[model samples]
Target chain A: MSLSEFELIQRYFAEASTDASVALGIGDDCAVLSVPTGQQLAVSIDSLVQGTHFLEGTPADLLASRLFGSALSDLAAMGATPAWLTLALTLPEPDEDWLQLFSSRLAQLCNEYHVSLVGGDTTKGPLTLSAQVHGFLPRDHRLTRAGAKVGDLICVSGCLGDSRGGLDGLLNGFENHTEAGYLLERFYAPTPRIELGKILLGKANSCIDISDGLLSDLSHILKASGGLGARLQLEAVPISSQLIATFGEESARQWALTGGEDFELCFTLPPNYLALLSQLPVPVAVIGKVTDRADIELFLRGEPCQIQGSGYDHFQRKDD
Target chain B: MSLSEFELIQRYFAEASTDASVALGIGDDCAVLSVPTGQQLAVSIDSLVQGTHFLEGTPADLLASRLFGSALSDLAAMGATPAWLTLALTLPEPDEDWLQLFSSRLAQLCNEYHVSLVGGDTTKGPLTLSAQVHGFLPRDHRLTRAGAKVGDLICVSGCLGDSRGGLDGLLNGFENHTEAGYLLERFYAPTPRIELGKILLGKANSCIDISDGLLSDLSHILKASGGLGARLQLEAVPISSQLIATFGEESARQWALTGGEDFELCFTLPPNYLALLSQLPVPVAVIGKVTDRADIELFLRGEPCQIQGSGYDHFQRKDD
Candidate 1:
């Protein structure tokens, strides 16, 4: 018998949930979950369409990773502990092989993050996946983009521009190169810094995930923090060896500034907490400092530098 | 300036939440909400794609209502009180007029249901709307499809055939007929029986929302309930006057049996509680009884009748 929607859910999607907080999982009109007392539930939704978000040749496993990872990154940005997620998947047709790979990878990711796939929907259409991720944080402890102060030290976890390099490599037919492979992996499976986000909860004054390039995403924090700006030391912005070796320093620096989908945490902390950051498990770099001015400034080798373009704008054509 | 995704959200979606449980609303990486103590959160997701779930010329306002209304019906089926919702909308282009009408209607519906639009994502792609709705119910009081007993009485709220009649009218160029208007409205914007669901909690043995026709959706309840079946009295199944007026008795009866998108609650309750159903605000019809046999039986004029099909199956071709 061909797999019906109900059968698809029962066989592939309705795995037993490991989360104690999930009172009920798949196979119901709604999944029931428990939120512990003194905690607030954090909810975020993201949709990724075939050509708009990922290329046509992307693997099913990688597509699953990219979609869920990007969605979970929002929970990371909020400093919430990932708990449960629901996926609404639309497809041109049902392919059992593709479904198996997608569901397995998604389940693996959920297992690693201790999140349960509580509920979702499946429909026939052009390829699109929308995930709604839920997490929880102690009341009043969430890190918001509006909390940055003028004197805060701007910090970022891990190197930036790697995912952009990966995307460029894929577009330019450079995926066979060893360096390109690493970049492609970064682009296809960007890791959400959930642990770092939880650690930065009270210490970081403001935070955002670098999805739309550092400049654009940081601008969100700046705008939300009452018109505060930032001053960046170009030399301090971390770039991966693969990116620099493939495209050289100048191009790598440009990608680091404007290439989107890094999925790294960009946060601001008081100068007093700089020493505490040393105790963090992940390598963090102080890229800049928050400024009272209302626009970002860049300095390369102590000389003011002009940067072209901010970040990806969905509605604006590239040539515009 | 062109309408950027951020600008579009700010202009239309960033509304103040009426729900006090919403600790944080739009314009953040995540929306934070509080679930009342002693309650479990109920989560469900639904997606509507162009040409599949809806027609090309469907009004934006009606589309919004249908999408959210159907999603909310899942919560109603679970007997959960609606609390928060997130919408992920993918559009071909930014149409300000369309967006405004869609958002306003969605907001109005949320207001009527006291649900908060907490967070969402807006992307550019072929038109698709996915909504994830969250609700809450006391931990032990949830109504599930698995709870039906063989001896329980089967009941349904509101008329069943109207939406199907409406769909037929839309497809057959009969939409302009005055008699078809009510059916069209029913198809375009079927109201979720939330109040009735809430009233049925603790009283109903099992419940499910009618979306994919009476038989197909009830089959879900039966399958979930484990080896249970139902005996539906064809004569007693509720049919609207509009449906009978548009199409004669036989066609109307068939539509009532197999046409989908009703968004009405079909529930089973113990025989003793049948009288209590009279207190419900909406019309409740006793259509049948739960059966010990493992397959649904239909009787017309107390004579066994053969039915051709049950309901819409996403993967199955119409001809099959």
Candidate 2:
């Protein structure tokens, strides 16, 4: 039997939300949520299209995981606790089997992240998924990109460029080596650094998730912080062993600098707070320092070097 | 100059939010909002596709108003005070003039409704607009569809079926008569009955926005309230003079009973609380009463009547 929109929601996503914060979940014109007295809400939205963001044949569970993790990373950048989620899922048609796996993975993530799947709308259109995540932080407390000072030390969590490498391998059809498999996993399921965000709440001067690569996202911090700039010690940039083995050190380093979809957190901290890095849940790399210069400068082995691509632009034609 | 995603946001949507509740607005990883103490958050999301929701040549400002007004109606149904909005705007390409008109109208609506344009994502894809609206209500105080009791008086705010008439006129290319123009306006910009929603709070037993026509939306209330049904007095159903003139009384009545996208409120009230109807901001019609039966029964001049095409379902094929 063909499923109507109501039946589709009832069968696949009815029980996807079971968080205490959701006073009313699904089936309503609006989902009602209870906010704690002392907490503020942090909300972010991300959209993933079939051809623009991923291949058409991508697995349903993996797509759900990728979209959820990347969206939640925005809250992680704000040092906020994940609380609620709303989705607007547009599909070309009602694919029951695809929806089953997608919603199962979504529910699992909601459980893992302790977020309530409060509401969603299912519509018929070209395949596009928009996920809005709402997180909470104590009143008047948050990490913003505008707090980086000229002397602050720039830092990043985890090795960058693995997701980009994974995308590259997927496009080129790499052999099923262990390294290739690791990169594929990175592309499919990124870990939102929520716990690390919590640890850096008070100490980090500024923070942002590395979604459009370290260079692009870090430049946002610089631009937001009164046009302050940064100098990166390219030698200190971290690269995973698997990524290096698959794509060579030179390409891996370039991807670390300019590749996108790395959901790791990049932040700035004062020199006095450097000791706090030792207590972080993930490995920390101090690769650069904020500068007064107004533009990013790169130096490798004591010599300046130029990068090829600045970052991803959804509108501007890449070649131009 | 061709605009990148960042440039487009900075140029068009940077100043869209100025509400005090927004601690941080556009240009942040997550927009931080200060939810007032003793208030719960109410959220809803709606998506409008290019071919599915509207025609290709629809004016940008009209499209913006339609999407925003319709999305906000969900909060209105819950008796929540509208507050913040996030848009996931997927466009085929960035047309500067179109963006100007669209964003200008969106900013105007934000001002008119006291809603902050907190944050949004712009991407290159098929033209699909998804809007997620946030609102605030008193803690533990909300109108749910499950609250209706059998024998309650059924009430509807404003005239219904005008939007459907408007849509039909548009699709059929009606002459530019005054009635046709009114119906077109109704189709392009249906008002959200937020004030009436506030008036219904604490008095109405249950309430919902009539988006998917009377039968379909009321059926939701019935199912939510444990299968209690309703009986409609067809003569008492309100239809606009414009709709009746544009489309004969018979078709208008049918549309009033079963047409969708009206964006009006439908609620149930106890007989003792019937006097509250006089205090509503909009005209309301008492066209029905709750019943113990599990299916809607309609009466026309004391005789049984039947209606066709229950309502719009996104996934269900119309032929089925």
Which lDDT tens digits does candidate 1 get at residues A121-175? 8888889989999999998889999999998999998899999888788777663
- In candidate 1, residue B43 scores what lDDT? 90
Q: In candidate 2, how many Å is residue A180 off?
A: 1.9
| Retained true contacts (fraction), each candidate | 0.85, 0.80
Best by DockQ: 1
**DockQ versus reference, model 1:** 0.65
| Candidate 1 local distance difference test against the native | 0.85
lDDT of 1 by residue, B41-121 (tens): 999999998988788868899999899889999999999999888888988888888888888888788878888888888
Docking class of 2: medium
Q: Distance from true position, residue A111, model 1, in Å?
A: 0.8
Query: After superposing candidate 2, which stretches have Cα over 4 Å from the reference?
Result: A1-16, A175-177, A317-320, B1-16
Residue A139, candidate 1: alpha-carbon lDDT? 87
lDDT by residue (tens digit), candidate 2, A1-320: 01255345445545555567788887788889887778888999899988778888899999999999999999999999999888898889888888888988887887788877777888888999999999999999999999999999999999998998998898886544679878988898999999999889988999999888899999989999999999999988899999988888888998998887889999999999988879889999999999999999999988998888876666663452
Interface RMSD of 2: 3.5
**DockQ for the candidates, in order:** 0.65, 0.61
Model 1: CA > 4 A from native: A1-3, A6-16, B1-18
